[model samples]
Target: MSNFARVRPIGRRRDGRPIYPIKGGSPTLTEQRDEVMRLLQDENYDGDVAELLQRAERIAGEIELAQQREARLRHLRGLTPPGDPDPNPGQRQQPGNQPDNGIPDPVSAAEAFVRSEALRAFRERGLRGESGAVEFRAAPAGTVTTTTQPQQNTRVPGIIPQNPDFPLLVASLLDRQTSDGTTLEYMRDTSGPQSTWNKAAVVAEGADKPKSGPFTFDLISTSLKTVAHWVPITRQAADDNGQLMGYINGRLTYGLEYKMDREILTGNGTTEMQGILTTPGIGTYQPGSGSTDPKLITVRKAKTQGELALYPPTAVVMNPMDWQDIELDEDANGQFRVIANVTDPGAPTRLWGLVVVTTVAMTAGTALLGGFRTGATLWERQGITILMTDSHADYFTANTLVVLAERRANVAVHTPAAFVKITFAALP
Candidate 1:
């Protein structure tokens, strides 16, 4: 047979390297060994042909090991392989043939073969719904009892696939709580958003002139919101698929987390939770008239706003693109403005005494500065959860499983004035 006869090309890489999909169930050791020998006999083979022979040898070795394991398993389970006849067919075992141990011989070889065949059918067609029927014939009386061992469970290498890089979220940097209560309630002073200090004048003994009124308070509330997404996968894919599950679940979790982060920064309070940017009466800042670098001005204004509200801003969140612009900004002399020197150690994540969080969630031309722990709270009803079920419509009949990943949380900014939103021109 031609060397490439059994191999079917699946696709090619960008560089045109041919890719082949592995086909067929596990082969017998003798078949694998013979294939390897045939490849070895090709003396005129070059580098690629030699590589093929090497792969065949490796496969042969694996098959031999598998056969040994199969034999051991068969011995333990009292199953018989084809061509191996049990001395007793359908008759009850004689005491002489029976072991002293009370346990009777496992299932007869025929029963084992039937089970094996059924399992093979399940693996091949049950997942695809090609055939759901299984049939078996009774072994004739006095027929030899054969033993067949089940297949060993061999784990595939590289079970964990490489994951795509996901944007790190700043949501965790803020104050978080596992809320037992569904809604967040806090008291807000209505008399004024901020507290004022009054200086007492040195006057007469019984000065009853100045009258101070009690501060008015209003209760503020925000409800917890649920964020979720679902992926529908064939039940076969969920079970038989190895590395693929890792990739799918990881990507799904990352996607959900990134969305939550963005919502905390910009979610509108209609059906979704209200975010810091949408929080009523939050602070705002604008860049100075002539300054090319807005980092300094941004931090100053935001910090000043929070300080004015009696809450000092502790973190700055901006888009990666904007941070890049700031980091690469040059002065008249061609020297970097943000980095002190060329050898500046790590990625500059700190600026103007505030922890800088660079994420794509923030708009390209906008930034948010806030005293996260003091101004707002993240109440998590449920963390990221993953589950698989066929309950989705028609999925049970269709052999499909729904992989759901979801989170329930809400962002409540009790002191909106303690946060600041800075909008600037989009960098070129």
Candidate 2:
């Protein structure tokens, strides 16, 4: 008999691996085993470790069963060799075929043959999908294995997850509130006197009470703007739970936050929120001409300006470059200027008793010190929403899907005088 029963292949895998009869699965055991090993060696593999260990154990068990099955098939084939014919219709063993030992029962001798046939039949049922069976040894190497082209991404080892380092954000310092309408309207006490108290003095001897000019206010109205983006993915990718979640948590969600942060600080305000730097009436401080002040002193002077405006700054926002300069600054003694523990990673970033928020959103040469809790309010007409649809463009016909992320909000610098914009550029 031939070493292997030659039968047509069932089908080919996406990876160009051939699927054979006994194996009964597109990816044979070796393909799956390679995936687990590849993931273990991968530096970026984020899959659960325990699951892989369990899968390897199952694969080992299946391989042992395959070897046992091969032994049984060989024994069955040898019972009736090819080209041998049983000529008699009711063939019974003659005296020549009888056992050499005296008087062995015919029934006892037939028992061994019956048991072997039962095992072979049972194993055949498993190959036909009648029972739980995995792929087995069917390759030319005598060990089960599958091959794939290097260029085929459809049949990848495993879904590789993403981990991104989003920049330090400053939006958390600003007060947040939700709104129901598109337009956000509020009245600001724009022209408050330096001496708000004792505006109206008490009159003596029934004299007419002094009339303080009516408090001045300016109407401020801002329209909510949309921050939105979408990505196109294959329908198959969208259905993959790991791939979909990684896109949202790593890329799409990060995009929304990054755009919103830039808008809150430097948006043009015509098509976007009226960012703190663009809002009118806020104080501005720069190093005076001929003054060789460092970025650290400039930020401190800006904080004083906010205090002078009667709204002491609660937080300071600067470019990461500027913050790094400040953190690295040293006095003539060569000791660090800032007295805090420099090596403590968990320490909160603070400057002049105010919360320090460093972000690239703020220009490299500028900083903002403000009473963020009271100076500006972030109005959310709609919170961030994520939607998946196959109806976008030609995605439906092309078997593609769209993942969209959107949010609507406007920035209103209510007490404009409370914020101080600091220019760190050297003044001539």
Candidate 3:
């Protein structure tokens, strides 16, 4: 085999000199480095054939490296724009100028990025005819590049201010208020003690001036009540965000109105508004069987109560959970028994010819079905009103504002017998 085809030795000797190949074997480029080092240190060594050969190899290696550097310089020159000064004047250009395979240098890339970002900002701001400036900040070593500053130190997305409409659940179910806002007095006529006296039948046309009958009359009266709530917020919040104050006021009003609705439905009269649920003479139905069909009991008890009172039931109020059970009840064939389909935008609100009002205020397992409007009246002394002020103690000095929502209203059950409470046994 030819010497050029032989495999060369690798690595250095124990004496710190590299292991060179045997005669006729070609010296590897790797050995050129050691040969160059030897040439630098060995002053007394004469130029023998072997030494000359080693020197020649070292020189040839140097020439090859110079050629490669020239080629790289030529490539860089091609990339550099005309008339641009060198970034490192009077110093050797670092290999960082052109990383692996001619990729852009870090410093140049950063400058270009800054320019592009500045130009973009200028254009977005529409600052025509104005020059833009970019500031450079040295990042800590090993910091990952990011398009934006870290959220912890930068302006992150702020809490999306929430505005929810939790309007009164039961108020909407009540008949609309129509009272002229006049007086708190409500009057109803009642049968007197002798109002039920019956007349004796007279002989054909012979009436002895029907025995004088007694006439009597009675009256019923109810007064109005009120409800209110308030919220305090910074003036800056109210002023900076146009909707902030309005949202607070509206939410407070809904909260107050909702409480009023509950009070009107179930309040005890002692220190609270009188509601129909506690009114005297109101009917009550107990299913007593947890397994009893919800739909059957609801309609049957409501109709019976209405019949007894000589008035038909018009509405039913139940907890949303209880209503869900009634609405989702299935038959043996898997068909919806209480509600076949509900096209309403929200939860189901009607069932079996009665307006079904599902509210969180009503207790689960209990429902009220009655002629709500026909048997009762919602009297109003003053409608809902929203007011803002800095008049509260320390509010004006603290840059704070007070927002109030209030209403004056009362409920009167003219015919308590027209309403009925239907209670279901607890679920298993």
Candidate 4:
């Protein structure tokens, strides 16, 4: 952030040529570096070449120290991951370890597995073809290389490892928890407070208190189910490309999330997670007979039903097509209705003051609005774990390996009334 001065010509040579030499003013480290460059390059510089050279050496040391300090600050502020420590002050990162392509080295889990002892042993004992695929190991971790100049102006490609994880839409909206057991047992209230909460009345003195019907509840026990998929790739691909390995792992994990998201809203209880729509006793909303209600109006009406049930809906889950219509819906003046900060993107998807999850998970012409974070919970028994094995179904002989990714999870809807499933259809 410091405004370092550019190098200025100090004086003129005897023949009137401009002469640039070290001057008295306090120059910035960068400016000092420029002075050093001038002293080395200019034959007519007045200062002593040897003493000035010594000062130049000190300036170089300062520049290196400054770079390391900046890197450390960036790490502390969470700009980038930490790198190997500098053993000595002002020393450059080791020559043989740094990458020529200027990418900061980050060890992803899949890459870690490839570099692990287990994979190495597998490579040694397992089959090989011709000279066999050589095991490729990434060089020692490199520090993030950045410059003070703007990215567009910097000559070196300033690259860093971007987070490869997917933005979980539905999963992120749900209340997620870790479970130790295979089955999750939770009580779902049927009557809740609406029908069974009128018992408490004002009773004076020793008058007998009126007893109302007890709130009904059903013991819901849902078993953790596995959602998984696998991909087959050659041993050569796995060993040679760590980035590819990470890419596969990230995508596989995302696949599990995608299915889980769909299941949370539509899965039949017998097979998978008990979806909110399929769960019994939840409120339902539909347009009146022969009444034409737009999606914007339909969502508001559904939200009111949830509120009337004494559960304020937190989010609305709709098919992308439905939301597309809503976003593009025009008023009488033809102005597009939903202005979602399109000019300044990255806004959270929202509608009617509730979070909107627009995914293919929900059936077209239908929507579900719910207090998902409170009405239901997602229990993850085992998170997404990736495993590669060449021993599956003669894959070992075929020189192929299967990368299996899976997770064990279940959904529990505690208060069914806290959700409302809307059928965007008119009574026929």
Q: Candidate 3 lDDT (Cα, whole model)? A: 0.55
Task: Write down the RMSD of candidate 1 (Cα, Å).
Answer: 26.6
Order the candidate numbers by lDDT, best to worst.
Answer: 4, 2, 1, 3
Q: What does candidate 3's lDDT look like per residue over 1-428, in tens digits?
A: 66676554433454555565667676555566666566556665443557566666767878799889988886664464445456333222332222111111233222222234442463344335332332222222122123433222122231111122332245544443434343344433232112133344555666465553453222444445667787886756544322342343345645675687789888885456768788776778776555554655565666675666566787788887887788687778998787545463444346667767666778887888887765676655544554555566777678676666566667766666667788876655
Q: Extract clashing residue pairs from model 3.
A: none
Q: Which ten residues in a row have the lowest lDDT in candidate 1?
A: 95-104
* RMSD, one per candidate, in order: 26.6, 29.3, 34.3, 17.7
Clashes per candidate, residues 3 or more apart or on different chains: 8, 0, 0, 0
If scored against the real structure, what TM-score would every candidate get? 0.53, 0.56, 0.51, 0.63
The true-versus-predicted C-alpha distance at residue 228 of model 1, in Å, is: 0.6
Best by lDDT: 4
Candidate with top TM-score is: 4
lDDT of 4: 0.67
Off by over 4 Å in 2: 1-168, 192-214, 339-346, 392-399, 425-428
Q: Is candidate 1 or candidate 4 better by lDDT?
A: 4
So what's the TM-score on candidate 2? 0.56
Candidate 4 TM-score over all chains jointly:
0.63
The count of residue-pair clashes in candidate 2 stands at 0
